[model samples]
Target: MAGTETHYTLPRPTFDEAPKLLIVVAPYYKDIADDLIAGAKAEIEAAGATWEIVEVPGALEVPTAIRIADRTADFDGYVALGCVIRGETTHYETVCNDSSRALSTLGLAGLCIGNGILTVENRDQAVVRAAVDQQNKGGGAAAAALHLIALGRKWTGGEKQVGFRPVGA
Candidate 1:
């Protein structure tokens, strides 16, 4: 008699088990913003967790939203989505730099805000990057959030095996 083989599957942690997620998006580039939102929503829902979308006037306003959102509740993580294309003026640089800096501060404070903002040379590139493709940055941002959230949980001892010892116990 031939024996049947069974494949073992690893259980995927459900999103409901995590804290919560907030997605903050900049509406300056509405088209690209739409792309980022679409991708982000897919990932969030696929994880089986709740997600809220907040809009900012422009890239300059993303960090503030993140800060306020982070403080309001215990979010599992956050995703900051924006697209800034370089123009003939230096205004592009300023917005990109300032927003990046502000978000970095929040992350350092353990906000777990995913920096999915794209600073592209042109609208075409930004659109391509934001699309749901290999270059889809929205997914990348969500992944970062997931990783950070898990890291935080581990550091805070979310795992049950943290204090486990050998059979000698």
Candidate 2:
């Protein structure tokens, strides 16, 4: 079973300056979301990073929230948390695909985002994944964001240079 499988987790990243992350959560599933938040917060703190959170209505809105924050806020990275359990209708696929795609698009555009939104066949799967002591997908997501932030800082040397510059000037 997946619960019994072992996976290698990357060591928590280190930084010269602590990163400030914005956690955007979709609290459609209150209990599940809370557990996810707990795990993510623990991971963020463990890495000597700081975080602030904002809630959106559902999974689909999580990416939009992150995009807005990236444009108008000063966060170094973002953690996206939510739960989407399959239901009787086709809404599950739409929510799952669109949200995942948007988050990926933003990531490709150089936004450091950890996507923790769970798309499960049932509530039981979500519960297991969200549990802080179990799968802890939330923590995994935070670690991903932190690693990306570390990489970004390393490559850019913490500088943002816009516009064209002469090569070997």
Candidate 3:
């Protein structure tokens, strides 16, 4: 069974300079959000990184807040945390897709973002995922962001200018 399978986790990364990260959370489910935040914060601190937290209304706002921070804040990375339990309506799909898309777009645009938003069938699944003793999705997300930040730093000196060059003057 998938549940009995062992998952391979990447080795935790170390950094010469402490990375600063912003954690944006949608606390629609307060308990779950709190658990996620705890896990994420622990992971960040374990990596010798600093982080700040901001609360949004719901899952949809998590990415939006991250984008805003990316534009105005000096954080090296961002962690997006939230839970979206499937309901009777189609709102679940909309929230999941849009939030995921926005985060992906921002990541592609050069922002280091860890997306921990949970889209599960019920609260039980969310609880397990958020628990630090369990899946610890929050920690997984933070680790992802840290890895991306490391990659970004690794390539910083090799950045090439890309744009149209006025017809080779």
Candidate 4:
């Protein structure tokens, strides 16, 4: 038999110092939402940051909460969690498109939003994706925030910290 190949896994990124995290959640799918929040909290804690959770009505409200939170300059970054399952009408498309756009605009302005708003076809898919697995999207979003912050530090001449406090606020 041929020898089996082995692969080495890398360690998760650790901050030089822990930063604060603001989490915005849309409780459309309670089960999925709870799971996502748990995964995100665990990752944030592991990275040595304090985390706070805020609840909104549903996916339609996530981006707005993120934008509002962005105005505060309170946390280093943010994570948005919600589930949008497609239906017969195009309402799903509209929500997904709009939410994604708003989040991107916030990110461009130096507010790192994880954008974990799940647009799945059904509840089962949402459940499977939100938990503490290797592919947990919530955990992935938390990691995204951490990575973006690191990249920001590189770009800002070693400033290493950025608060929201959007202009004209």
Candidate 5:
């Protein structure tokens, strides 16, 4: 049972400047979404970071929102929160695969993103995972974004100069 499983969690990363993050959530399941938001908010605050929240219509839109924010917003990182409970239709698979892929693509493009979307067998699983006191997938996602932000700051040797310059000084 997942409930009985134990896993090691990394200590929260510290930041010289408090990171600003945007939390994009799809509230298809209102209660679940609320729980997820709560967990994510708590985690962000605990790390001494600040965050803002935005709601999209569904899971498929979560990545798009993040991408737009990355381009036009001054956020240091992003946290994606949503719940996709498997249904009788194949739409579940589509949402799960497409959303995950899009988020991965954004991450590969250098956007610091934390994917907290819950793809589960049913609402029961989502409830358990989203609960702030339980798995807290939301918090886990926030933690992921924080870690990536730390790595980016650590390795960023200032902006690389593009194009050519004059020969020698």
Candidate 6:
């Protein structure tokens, strides 16, 4: 089974200047959400970064909160956490696809984001993936954000101008 296979993880990254992050979570499943939050927080702290958290109503709102924070807050990166289990209707697919697309769009727009939202077929799957000692997808998401933040710092001051400049004498 996939669970029994070995996988490679990148070495934990560090930063010269402490980074500030925002964690946005949807607590539809409170227990699952709590577990994800714990794992993400642990990883962020271990990387010597500080984080703030906000809870949204559901998975669809997680990205919106991140975008709001990105626009008006000073966080260096964001971690999105939630759990969406398949239901009898098609709502599950909509939530999964839209939330993911929104986050991806923000990421492409140069906002450092780690997407930890879990879309699973059942509660059992969500439990396994959310466990800190198991899949630990939350930690994985935090790591992703950290890595992107590191890259952003590395390229900061080295960016080339791309468009028109103000008229000079």
Q: Pick the candidate with the highest TM-score.
A: 3
Candidate 6: Cα lDDT at 94? 100
Candidate 6 lDDT over residue span 53-92, tens digit each: 9999999999899989988989999999999999999999
Model 1 worst lDDT run, 10 consecutive residues: 1-10
Q: How would the candidate models be sorted by lDDT, starting from the highest?
A: 5, 2, 6, 3, 4, 1
What TM-score, to 2 decimals, does candidate 1 have?
Answer: 0.80
* Best-fitting candidate, scored by lDDT: 5
lDDT of each model, Cα atoms only? 0.79, 0.95, 0.92, 0.79, 0.95, 0.93
For all predictions, the C-alpha RMSD in Å is: 10.4, 2.4, 1.4, 7.0, 2.1, 1.5
lDDT of 5 by residue, 120-145 (tens): 99889999999999999999999999
Q: After superposition, how far is residue 35 of candidate 6 from its true place, in Å?
A: 0.7
| TM-score quality measure for candidate 4 | 0.82
Off by over 4 Å in 2: 157-169
Model 5 residue 140 CA deviation in Å: 0.4
Estimate candidate 3's RMSD in Å.
1.4
* TM-score between candidate 5 and the true structure: 0.93
Residue pairs in collision within model 6: none
How many collisions between residues are there in candidate 6? 0
Q: Report model 3's TM-score to 2 decimal places.
A: 0.95
Candidate 3: misplaced stretches above 4 Å? 166-169
Residue lDDT tens for model 2, 83-163: 999999999999999999999999999999999999999999999999999999899889999999999998886566789
